[model samples]
Target: MRIVRRVFVPTLVVVVAVIVGSGIAGGREAFGGAAVGGGLTLAFLGASPGLLDPVAKASPVASLPVALGFFTVKAVAAVAVLMLLLGDDGRGPQLSSRAVAAAMIITALTWVTLHFRALRRVRTPIYDLG
Candidate 1:
């Protein structure tokens, strides 16, 4: 929760910047693409912690496999959806593929950087032998 919140704010800022930049540079299609990109980024990454936390808490050993599986599923689904939307030549109806790709990349980087920084700062006991 705390980590998510910390990352969310900065990610939102980056998303907004990406959207605005795309809109200015590429017009309407790009704007929509940027919006969707940022939204998907938020939806996919934002839901991760909430979905995985319980699994981690209940069975730490299973968490890694679960996370990897979850990620694989997401990636496949996303690719399928994008393929349907973008077609063979990346020509979507009204969405600019470049804008979508750029926004997703920027937001994801922001989320990862913030997440790792926060994780590093967390204080934990060196040993818990009971």
Candidate 2:
């Protein structure tokens, strides 16, 4: 929870950049990107720092499997939730299929970029042979 604010400060820049870009290209897409990207990425960021907290005990190589399994499950569940919520014509987004697609792309990019940066910066012992 303490890290959420710090982590998100950087992402706010991305949200604004995407919003401005998407707004010029498409208003609804901008809105959808902000809503979904902002919401989901923040949620992901909030959970992720802690999800990999245990990985601090492991080497980067050892952390891969844990990280992979963690994200695969999260991705599958996210898809399932979206499937139930969004209709064929993207009824839930209040915009269009295009906007929903924008949102998904925005969320994914934001998550991946930030998470990779976090992983790089995560603290680990200098010499943990395991």
Candidate 3:
């Protein structure tokens, strides 16, 4: 919920703005961005709970392997899902493959950044004075 409010929501705003701007500025490319953004959003949202679940229970060393593995799987799944939804290389009528790629990359990076931010918010003492 906090992640939704703090990260996903804000990222969505930016992605949507890109969609609108691209529509006006880039015309067809806007659809490409929308597809990428929307797909990425769904992919990450679905996977986030599972990823975060292990983070809470495992040591950081242990967590890294799980996180990396899941991240890779999620990324691959995102691409596969987009290919199915958007067609070959994210191209369809009036769609720009480049724009779709750009938006997907942006969405992925934004999600990672937000994940880190959420992790930081977890209350853990580095050095217990007591």
The model with the greatest TM-score is: 1
TM-score of 2: 0.55
How close is each model in CA RMSD to the real structure? 1.6, 4.9, 3.7
Off by over 4 Å in 2: 1-7, 16-33, 58-66, 91-93, 110-130
Q: What TM-score does candidate 1 get on C-alpha atoms?
A: 0.90
Worst 10 residues of 3 by lDDT: 41-50
Could you give candidate 1's per-residue lDDT for residues 28-113 as a string of tens digits?
Answer: 99998899888888878988898799899999999999999999988887787778766788978999999989998998999999
Given candidate 2, what's the lDDT at residue 26? Answer: 70
lDDT of 3 by residue, 55-118 (tens): 8576666777777778788778877876775687456566676667667677767777876888
Worst 10 residues of 2 by lDDT: 91-100
Off by over 4 Å in 1: none
Tell me the deviation in Å of residue 43 in model 3. Answer: 3.4
Task: Please report, in order, the local distance difference test score of every candidate based on alpha carbons.
Answer: 0.89, 0.62, 0.69
Total clashing pairs for each candidate: 0, 0, 0
Ranking by TM-score: 1, 3, 2
Query: Global CA lDDT of candidate 3, please?
Result: 0.69
Worst 10 residues of 1 by lDDT: 78-87
* True-structure RMSD for candidate 1: 1.6
Strongest candidate by lDDT: 1
